[model samples]
Target: MFDTMTMTKVVGGLCGTFLVFLLGGWAGDIIYAGGGGHGDHAQAYVIEVASADDAGEVVEEVDFSEIMATASAADGEGLWRNCRSCHSLEPGVNSTGPSLYGIVGRTVGSEDGFNYSGALVAVADVWDADHLNGFLENPKGYAPGTAMGYNGMRKIEDRANLIAYLDSLDD
Candidate 1:
């Protein structure tokens, strides 16, 4: 049979552990609570995030024609590494996205077997140089609601180069 001293020691040990846990929790709340004020105090530091519009102004816009004139298909082949996971450059082979073969002048949403979102079809009829430039620059922006998950090439040169590479695919 267990003695009362052992019972008392067990109870005391549990109570001490509980007390320690409670105090630790209180200390953590005080350290990490970030000043519980009702919108009275200003933030300690203001973070200045450059807006997309401001960034656009800082970077001079490059004309699609200029980029096309200077774009390198060799560099574009390297960039195509990003697209290879989702798209196939081969004709009639669709992967996560439709085959990009001959995409430069092809009709939007016109791949034979790939299922395209309504957004792409509604935006433009043909994927001309200018249209491709805009779409490759920002897929979601050019065609809102498009299922293509690409964030888009930020550099105009990259877009042009990619287009040139794709154009070469069919030739």
Candidate 2:
């Protein structure tokens, strides 16, 4: 025999559960459609522009092309004598250091069939005049923990001349 009280209790519980689910779904839809009450875009800091007079004086740009164009490979070759102890400038030759032949525009640690230091290998991007200049100025600074034992070139002109010499070796 079904009791009326028990049946009413079961129906009331079911109705309460259904109402909770329906309200939950409606609340979720309202929250989703309201766009979270946040701005459409993020705000950014505004950089202030300085006037020409307020900025530091404009320095004239020196043309290094003329200087590099006139630089002699012979001079660079002479300067490279310092590197001869640890490196060779000839192709297919690996000395204490890797070959310097055609190294001006080559990658930082790109000598084939040679064991390069992990420090140098970490930065294998292409080497150009500016990169070589920085490396020659301070090899350790340029590529920290590099194996090259030579101290950096002190003078910028020396680096330029060395670069000119290295450029001549390429086919």
Candidate 3:
């Protein structure tokens, strides 16, 4: 039968467990307290980085063609994994985007059955390395109204490598 003593013991056990947790948290807070207001605590250690202005290093503009010439198709093949979801490497096969098999020199927005947005055609006539570079660098930026929602590959090396790989597929 449910008795007053049995209920009191059960309640006491719960209160004891709660007290243990409360005391433990209070102790931990005291032990780990930083003792400073917002943004006032000293950094554990400072990492010194050189400022571009202070370094006075001249950054020469890199030629895109030169970068493209050195691109490795093999490296680009690895990067293609990212594009695999939307585009097909096989000619005549279209996915969310058009096939990229002959993209290197193919006319923009000319993929047979794929409904390309007018954005790509408006930006460039052909998918040459240069145009591909700009497009790969920023898809939405290059073609403002294109359906290619990919944010873009940011690095020039990556864009060059991907183009080289696509070019190699058709050759």
Candidate 4:
């Protein structure tokens, strides 16, 4: 049978212990902590990274034309599966997206029936390889407010292959 007074003493002891531990933690942190903010301490030595601008070296930017020169339409046919859900390869037939039938060489925003974002024609006159490359790399970035909701293909090879596959469709 524990009394109320005994219970109070036990509770007080536990709370006091907890407070001591808490204060110890606070003091220890104050005494042993590292500099609080980022870049507060001097770096010993920066490992020099070879950037394009550094070391009298210039990086030659590889154009997509060079990449597309080696693109494979056969492999690109596989990439077409991802587009089939929203686009059609048949000419004059529109899906959620307009028919990609002659898209590669076709005029921008000129796919007949399907209404485009009106931002595309401002970017380019035709859907040439270079234009298509930039568009496929970033739809919204290239056209600003295109209706296409695609996040865009990041790889140059994929864009080139897909462009090649679309080019092969009209031929």
User: Which candidate number would show the highest TM-score if scored against the true structure?
Assistant: 4
Which is the better candidate, 2 or 3, if ranked by TM-score?
Answer: 3
Residue pairs with backbone atoms closer than 3 Å in model 1 (clashes): none
lDDT by residue for model 4 over 58-143, one digit each (tens)? Answer: 55788888999999999899998888999998889998999999888888888889988788989999999999999888899999
Model 1, global lDDT: 0.87
Clashing pairs in 4: none
lDDT, residue 49, model 2: 93
TM-score winner between candidates 2 and 4: 4
Please give, for residues 1-171, the per-residue lDDT of candidate 2 as tens digits.
579999999999999999999999988877877655754665577778998788778766645565566677788888988888988888969989889898987877778978988886565588878778778889998899998887888866677899999898888
Tell me the TM-score of each prediction against the true structure: 0.65, 0.59, 0.66, 0.70
Taken over the whole model, the C-alpha lDDT of each candidate is 0.87, 0.82, 0.88, 0.88
Mind giving the per-residue lDDT tens digits that candidate 3 earns over 13-96?
A: 999999999998887776677423334667799988988778877778899999999999999999999999988888899999
Q: How much is 122 displaced in model 4, in angstroms?
A: 2.2
Root-mean-square deviation of candidate 2:
13.0
| Model 4 misplaced stretches (Cα beyond 4 Å) | 1-18, 34-59
Can you write out model 1's per-residue Cα lDDT over 48-161, one digit (the tens) per residue? 998877775555666679879988999889999989999998899999999999998788889999999899888889988899888888899999999999999888888888
Clashing residue pairs in candidate 2 are: none
TM-score of 4: 0.70
